[model samples]
Target: SLTKTSGTSSRSTSQLGRHFHHRTPGNFLDPEVRAFLEENTEVISSGNLTPEIRLRLLTPRCRFWKERADLWPFADPFWAIYWPGGQALSRYILDNPNIVRMGSVLDLGSGCGATAIAAVMSGASHVLANDIDPIAGMAMVINCELNNVNPFPIAIKNITDTKLDKWDLIVLGDMFYDEHLADCLHHWLGKCIKMYGTKVLIGDPGRPQFTGHSIHRQLHKVIEYSLPEPTRRENNGLTSSIVWSYQP
Candidate 1:
């Protein structure tokens, strides 16, 4: 079972309500995702409800992967919210199959293991999926199995941890929004890439922090994504996205 964090009064209690209230273009959760949640209903309802639980319960039901069936069993809501780029990157890798053949890959901030699974599907020799969120790690393990890929080793540790190993390719998905995270990831990614001859492949939806990286490939696939209606945040509509890959 997943652990839950304590919630403060400031947090809203409108998740189920928000899920049903919105009727935007990409509002409904994916059917397969919904099925996965329903299958795991017992686990989700077993513990004290918290933000993490709510997020996990909703993750497998989000419609961010309307364009890609390969991303089934979605892992994290924060990452799923920008899955267009992940699908685009996966498509790009599939098209250019040689880039991933037998390469050792590391998925940093691998929320839900979509990118890592995609890498393995595209021919990566080995993959290491790492995330700071324990639930996210569990999701990755489960999702990989669901996708028929061998469950790669998962580390529930931050990218900036003192004990870190190198890989031939580092795949980063939707982790560039926060300035601090982007900065720390950039530094560590550079070190890993340089030391291991690794290629850094990133999938981002044009967030501000994605500006300074040296881009090798930019895919122009515009995928429509539905935002979770309950968040009540800005940008809850359809948006265009891109997949940017680079070698540092």
Candidate 2:
């Protein structure tokens, strides 16, 4: 006869033990998301945005990874809001060459690490890629590897807690969209530049708050590119790339 197991014995034998277990959904990738990924995989691998801009349908995967919330990264599809801006910023920085030299640089709201990769390529001694989304952090790691750049990942809850290591430059790309975020970021940026002597560079496509800021220099301007019908959202077709610099 088999030995009878007590309730305590059964509970102790189970993996859950005394704790309760909740079942969550697996695989967040939907059909649309998968299709978008498949379409842009090649373009992302190539690191070329010209064709993408012309096509206007290159959906970038920049979505936040919910499962890895601890990492705090931004998650969106590729070619989403920031990818184009990031590419434009990189191109402008490459063309100028004087703005980003060998120095400590930080890419705030790094997203998929496009600007950070550009910074590394532009000869920054060290690049810190920061984001509050774990998915974006993962993408940053992948993108950095693709571009042959090793970026330091910093998950920050707020810009106030950003490390004050006397960085030479801080790049903000497509971050000034909302009033609240823009205001908070602007305040932090002022502190970063005025107190730390860090050169603040911002890349925006004529967002509301972007216009409000007092810029020291407008370094470069890129023509607005139209997005494909499927991917076109608000301000999709009409957008101008502007690189503004501030020194405090």
lDDT winner among the candidates?
Answer: 1
Sequence-dependent TM-score of model 2: 0.63
Per-residue alpha-carbon lDDT of candidate 2 for residues 22-134, written as tens digits (9 for 90 to 100): 21112222343334333443333333432222112223343322223222111223322344455556666666556777788888777667777777677777777776544
Residue pairs in collision within model 1: none
TM-score of each: 0.60, 0.63
Give Cα distance to truth, residue 202, candidate 2, Å. 0.4
Per-residue accuracy of model 1 over 175-198 as CA lDDT, tens digit each: 666566666777777677667766
* Best TM-score among the predictions, by candidate number: 2
Output the TM-score of candidate 1.
0.60
Q: What ranges in model 2 sit over 4 Å off?
A: 1-81, 213-235
